[model samples]
Target chain A: TAGITQAPTSQILAAGRSMTLRCTQDMRHNAMYWYRQDLGLGLRLIHYSNTAGTTGKGEVPDGYSVSRANTDDFPLTLASAVPSQTSVYFCASSVLLAGEQFFGPGTRLTVL
Target chain B: SQQGEEDPQALSIQEGENATMNCSYKTSINNLQWYRQNSGRGLVHLILIRSNEREKHSGRLRVTLDTSKKSSSLLITASRAADTASYFCATDQYSGGGADGLTFGKGTHLIIQP
Candidate 1:
């Protein structure tokens, strides 16, 4: 079973361009999250969805936005990408709020 | 800012030896989880221990939680080359309502030499 899957394994975009990172989960989880991993900084949450149609801002939500239109998809968008936004983005899903999360392979985005 | 901080930023150990990493957090949490990530890859959940739980084990992984001290430790026994990766400790901060995201530590880079 494809527990979680992310699209566009890697991408390079010019600053000021818009991009969307796709994340999907087949586990039928109730909660989904988007995070960015950087060197020495660990993983920082960008956005999260408690359930379909509901989203919340996370620790680093300034440059990113997320939409949870359906139960299986949670896509993160960078309306105007910046060099600082270059990082490995991960999407995770959990059966419950405090339960263990399962992460996707990740999408590496480079803003130049 | 991160809620948890992992000690020994890096560790190198020979195969068959044991490796232990510690994590300290600043706030109350509903649970703490451990995850492993290979270079340039996504994280894989290893284990989770709740606030009231003291210790948990999964195969070669042993996790201990000390809520009083707001700290946790992950121990890997008989480490192998495949165990080389970055380990992170994430905390599910306790909240009154709504869903909460996890706060992660800087992580420990473990290198298991064969």
Candidate 2:
């Protein structure tokens, strides 16, 4: 089992461009999350899904959007990327909310 | 702002020694988790302790939680160079279904010298 897989291992996009970070998990977990890891800031949640078809905003959700159409995938979209949005993005899945999670390798994005 | 704050932003220790990292958070939580991230990699779940539990052990890892003080500590016995990485503490402020996912601390950078 792949556990969790993320696409676009790394990317360099221009400001105001649009991009989507893909996240898929074979664990069939009920909860999935999107987080951005930045220098000195740790990892901040951007969005989360309690289960398939339900999504919620997180601490730093202003510049990002997420959709959970199914249990295996939760993708985060940045409509207009900013320099500040350039950071390592991680996708995680847990059997239940607030439980131990399994995380993907991560997507490194650089916006210039 | 981050809810959890890990003490000693950075720590360097020699092999065979024990490395201890502390994390303190604000507010009540159902459980607290500790994760280790190697360079350019995703965070790996090391251990988790519930609010009611005082201490937990896993292999060479030991974790202690003090709900009254809202603090937790992670201890790695007989540290090796492979233990060199950034350690982060995460907590779910509310159990079950809280919109705000897990809150992570800035992390304690642990460097184990050979």
Among these predicted structures, which one has the highest DockQ? 1
Question: What is the lDDT, from 0 to 100, of the residue A50 in candidate 1?
Answer: 84
Candidate 1 deviant stretches above 4 angstroms: B95-97
Per-residue lDDT of model 2, residues B1-114, tens digit only: 687899889999999999999999998988999999999999999998989999999999999999889999999999999999999999986645554568899999999999
Q: What's the lDDT for residue A16 in model 2?
A: 99
Taken in order, the candidates have interface RMSDs of 1.1, 1.2
Score residue A26 of candidate 2 by CA lDDT: 97
RMSD of 1: 1.0
**Least lDDT summed over 10 consecutive residues: which range in candidate 1 chain A?**
A94-103
**For candidate 2, what is the DockQ-based docking class?**
medium
Let me know the TM-score candidate 2 reaches against the reference structure. Answer: 0.97
